[model samples]
Target: MCGKGVNGFMKRIYMDHAATTPTDNEVVKAMEPYFTQKYGNPNSIHSFGQEARDAVEEARKKVAHLIGANPSEIIFTGGGTESDNFAIKGIAWANQKKGNHIITSKIEHHAVLHSCQFLEKHGFRVTYLPVDKYGLIDPDNVKKAITDQTILVTIMHANNEIGAIEPIKEIGKVVKEAGIYFHTDSVQTVGHIPIDVNDLGVDMLSMSGHKLYGPNGVGVLYLRKGTRIDSLIGGGSQEKNRRAGTENVAGIVGMGKAAELAEKRLVQGEEDKLIKLRDRLIKEITEKVDHVLLNGHPKKRLPGNVNLCFEFIEGESMLLNLDMEGVAASSGSACTSGSLEPSHVLLAIGLPPEIAHGSLRLTLGKDNTEEEVECVIDILPKIIEKLRALSPFKGSWEGLKK
Candidate 1:
């Protein structure tokens, strides 16, 4: 809740929860013992090892409970990227005899897209489905894309850039009927929204700890009990030989506590509050800012995600100004922000490169408040106006108007 920026900015407001979240105090408290006094590899045979193993299994159960899966189905990994790589590659390699074709969307995270590309180079066929203007893939497209050679369908439950929620359950039913494995990168939606694997009909799903206010370097890939998937890493019998290397005991413990807290908040209607705040922010921004286009489905998007395009000014300029003004946001996904090219997600949805470059993503977290929204509303317009006044495009348009 502290908003102090590095350059002595008095009021720092973080609106980049989609990139990562601060670890919760309760989660930190739950992980304290494992880091020091009780530290031991879960594979060891000593008493300390037994204690660590017990804690890890208990954490597994907690994560499983959040998603309506069994503890044995959850295989811990490094993080969401690793989980995505494992799910996409694991299924492709395991079911190679059945088929070599994989179906995924163009708007997938690099983790999924790059894995599919890797498979493509290894003699696998990948079908990259396109999305609508609202950033949603049609279930009919998914059905039509399924060929006899298709072995896997890997799509994201919610997009990280635009926050568009995919119809995973409908797509899952199609994949289920086709007898192909289904995997979804639920890194954004898992903790923020209610998820039930059976309800979504996904055989595999990926989740990250940092996305849910847990420690980093910990994630889970939920593989249904009977799903056929190979290990991405070799060696060790950890995770029932499904994943290798010793477990991150403390990080796992923190993830469990974070999951439990998120579930509790859901039951208490905290998500509803977030929705209100998000909607209010959007409404005010649109009403006040001219030439600003809202990206993604207005109603169906993630409760805390507000992606907008402020035309005539580059997104990097807006971001830099926002940072100096003590507002933390992103021009795009953290992984792709460094690229000079416009965001692929925006381009996939048919945005011009210039407009795409002018995009900004403000994602709220549980700790964000209405006061923060007001502060942003007060500060952002001035920044945009100043940037627009200095823009050559704005000057040209004004000259033409005159």
Candidate 2:
């Protein structure tokens, strides 16, 4: 992780694991043969194709195993966004006869949000449920949102921006009792946490490979058996006629290997280790800085997520300063980067526009170390102090008042 910084060459600390991870060496090796030696279309009928087909099925099983789903129920897609679209639109269209109503939350990823918006234009009704100050969607809200014409309810297992873990299982129970289909965008939680589709009581779930140190071009949709969903793509009978496309052999193999490694790491207590780092970052930032607020549920959030809103200083300025010092992070959801507007997730969680503009998300990974955490803790305060001094609103800073 060494890099050329503003001062000199230094260690580059990555704190944007939620955006994507550095693909594991093992995953790269597993995918190497497929790009050349085992190059074959899984849809082909020849021996080369059969070999690829076998690898694809094996990868599907690995992905399913990670989430306690059946291999037969797994549907390979281009990425998380595609899986989300397939789930939301597929169910809405396929079961339109049953109802035209759908339910989701205000703090969902763009993939889910855009999908629901698209459905709303095409005669489908969608209810965007609100979250609490901590960004947790109330299960009772989901229960109350159901109508006679409700068809599906889509929510995320964990928020990508704030890392607030939602009550999917409880919401799942509510949807099930109403006989409405339920789907979850588990892209942020899938590889990082233990998940069981049956336990969550979800009819469908979406995940991306890159979030788990796998290849970037692959993802999966766990479509439980007997779920009514229409196919989005229609060219070949691939993916069991659910998602039609030739499988991404190399990427799929990489994702499968990554899934196995993620499962092993989770069972070996890697999550607890991340929690310690996350807490240290939060604790030090709060104690050493003024007018800063933690952005998510302190205990119910992800093990590796630390979102902080530092008043008076802008997030982009802080990110630029951190990058110059060889520390990498994000102001908000990576997908929404480059936008001048404040983060929608922060706003949804009740932060004012000025405070939301100051939010920063630091997501940890297995590769991060305590030394790195300590370095960040030391460097960040200096960066904040420098930025705050330059800020026009510095006179109003809580530290100045204190």
Candidate 3:
């Protein structure tokens, strides 16, 4: 409940929970013992090692329960990027004999997109599907794009920039009927939405720990039983030889704890509260601001996401102004380099460069309160007004009037 006070003039509020969240205190507490007193390699056969091994398994079960998957299906990795790589590259390489074609969307995170690009460089064929204006991928497109040579279809459950929730169940049904493997990068949706791997019919799913108020450097790749995928990192026999490396004991433990907490919150219906807060923020912003447009599906977005595009101002400038005001949010994906190219995801949805450049993403989290939402609403309009006034395009508006 503790957060920065609203200074009205200077107090900053954090609305960018989608980008990343601070590790919860309870998760941190669960991880503290593993980092120091109980630290032991799980691979060791000694009593100390057995204790660590027990914790890892217990954590594994928690992560599995969060997504309605069996404990055996969970494989820990260095985070969402690694899990994505394993799902895309690992599956493509292992199933190369079956076919070399892969299907994914243009709105995917760089992790999945770049992995597909890497496969293409090595002679694999990949089809980048386009999304609707709401950023939702059409399952029919997947069906149309599939061929006898199609080996895998990788799509994200929810977009990071605009929070567009894809129709995973429908997409999964098509992929299943086609007998092609379906991989979903659920980094943004796993903790925010209800995810049942069996119901999703996904052969593989990827999730990042930090997105769920857990420690960073930990991720889970849920490979359905009997799914075929090669090991990306080959070394010692760990993760049943599917992923080889020393287990990130503390991070895994924290991720498991966070996932368990997220499940509990879901059961208690905290989602309704989050959705209300998000909608309120969106309503207030759009009502007060001129030339602003909501950028994603109105009803099909994450409960905590509110993405908008304001005309004339640039995203980086808005982000900087918000940061200076103590409000922490992101203009777009954190993975993009310093190119400032106005988010490929935004452009993929058919947004013009000027509007896309003015995008702002406000993602809520468990720790955010209603007061914080009000504070952001009160402060954001003034900032946008100031930025638009200074923009070079503002002069163009005057010329048009003349």
Residue-level lDDT tens digits of model 3 in 278-363: 99999999999988889899999999999998887778888887887688988853233366576889999998776787888999
Worst 10 residues of 3 by lDDT: 393-402
Q: lDDT for model 3, please.
A: 0.90
Error of 2 at 296 (Å): 0.6
lDDT of 1 by residue, 336-372 (tens): 3777678899999998777788899999999999889
Please list all clashing residue pairs in model 1, or write none if there are none.
3-12
Superpose all Cα atoms of candidate 3 onto the true structure and report the RMSD in Å to 1 decimal. Answer: 2.7
- The ten-residue window of minimal lDDT in model 2 covers 393-402
Error of 1 at 310 (Å): 0.6
Task: Estimate the TM-score for candidate 1.
Answer: 0.96
- Tell me each candidate's TM-score: 0.96, 0.96, 0.95
Q: Write the per-residue lDDT of candidate 2 for residues 100-195, one digit (tens) a residue.
A: 999999999999999999999999999999999999999999999999999999999999989999999999999999999999999999878889
> Model 1: residues >4 Å from true position, as ranges?
1-9, 333-336, 395-402
Candidate 1 vs candidate 3, lDDT winner? 1
